[model samples]
Target: MLQDTFNLMPLWAFVAACGVTLVAGFVKGAIGFAMPLVMISGLSIFLDPLVAVAGIVLPIVMSNLLQVMRFSWAEARAALREFWRYIAVICVMILIAAQFVTMIPTQTFYLVLGVPVVILSLIQLVGVRFHISPAWRRPSEWIVGLISGTIGGLTGTWGPPTVLYLIALDTPKAKQMLVQGVVYGLGSVTLFLGHLQSGVLNGVTAPWSAALLIPAFLGMRLGFWMSDRMNPVLFRRATLVVLVVAGVNLVRRGLMG
Candidate 1:
């Protein structure tokens, strides 16, 4: 049955993935987060994790590049300087973790991702309040960077930890979004190179990546349009719920596997 299902995947699967990409992109564009989470979770339902990751890489890179480009060079440079150590650690860890991708079992992947989603969701849902001390922010930045990079390399979903850490910093929304875009843009480039080195960038994944751009662009446009109208509190709450559900589903899938 599994083999039959795999063999039977048709154009509709691609279409569905594209649709999800649109939604994910819109969310990212509008709010500056959730694209990776939304896209990877949604896409993983229809395709293998590796294919989903590959499909997302180009669109995310493009989207983030456009976002970061909107910022002035001075601002971008300042932000990069502030976070350079963190970024450096993340890049190095991502490269190292990428080497071990082939060693991760599918079930293990699901569990590793699933457990975190649940915990993060519950924290948000319950309104857990914890702040990183100013004195510790520098070191914490490095820690978050390492975590994000490692997870990103392994699962192709790397935004949550960085997002959480940035949120803790109390940065203005615009700055937060810009910094995320720039950081992710850098990470995406590194990730793409890593995948290429691992030989995961093949014709099959390449076409899928191209096809995904349409929906991704659509989503980004929608998200941009909706950004101002949406309430931040509501959006965060909804995202947490989605995370919880996705986490549970992934855990279940892992257990079954």
Candidate 2:
């Protein structure tokens, strides 16, 4: 089945892709986000860019469902209600932007996805926190949602912008995790559908995506266990460092490609 799906890709490359998903899942479980970023950056090193995007779809959807289930259905519903505007904008923008995915140059897509991730991750690492006043929250949500959705549609990674918006809001840690799960859960569904329309998730790629769910699930489960035993502050910083390195690697690939 795997060979039929990724006939052009070597067995080693397929194994490596599974490893990437495992690590991505671990990071998401530990720090509450970044699975797509890690998967995109790592898989693109070995797979076609569109294939990398498609490969993440199933794992992301499944991981997010697990994350959301960690909390109650009531909490998920409440989050959806509170952030409906942002969510709605993101869904619409993802559908619109996804149509152009096939038109973007691979190098341009890499730079577009990598540059912001590197810049934003560095800013957070350097202790620069964004602040949004109560009056500006509405507008900020719309703006960020649009940006996040567009980037997400293009690259299959939208956690950074969403995380930034949540940080600026000064959301409590517990609430932040729940909100991330809720937002990303819905966004993942849209991503799947958008790419389906774009032909990124057709018969050939869908099997590869589905196969990756195994490692992603295992890694995330282990990560959840580890997270309970580790210090969150330290884990988050470590995750950010990994993001910086992965982002830098993507930029390098773009420049060198």
Question: Cα lDDT of all candidates, in order?
Answer: 0.78, 0.90
RMSD of 1: 3.4
- Per-residue CA lDDT of model 1 for 110-202, tens digit only, reads 887778767766876888766888999888977888888888888766777777787688777888888888788888788878877775655
Winning model by lDDT: 2
Q: Residue 150 lDDT in model 1?
A: 88
Instruction: Give stretches of model 2 more than 4 Å off.
Output: 1-4
Q: Which ten residues in a row have the lowest lDDT in candidate 1?
A: 1-10
Error of 1 at 232 (Å): 2.0
Looking at model 1, residue 14 earns an lDDT score of 75
Summarize candidate 2's per-residue lDDT along 141-237 as a digit string, tens digits: 8999999999988888889899889999999989999999999999999999999999988888999899999999998998888889999888888
Candidate 1: deviation at residue 27, Å? 1.2
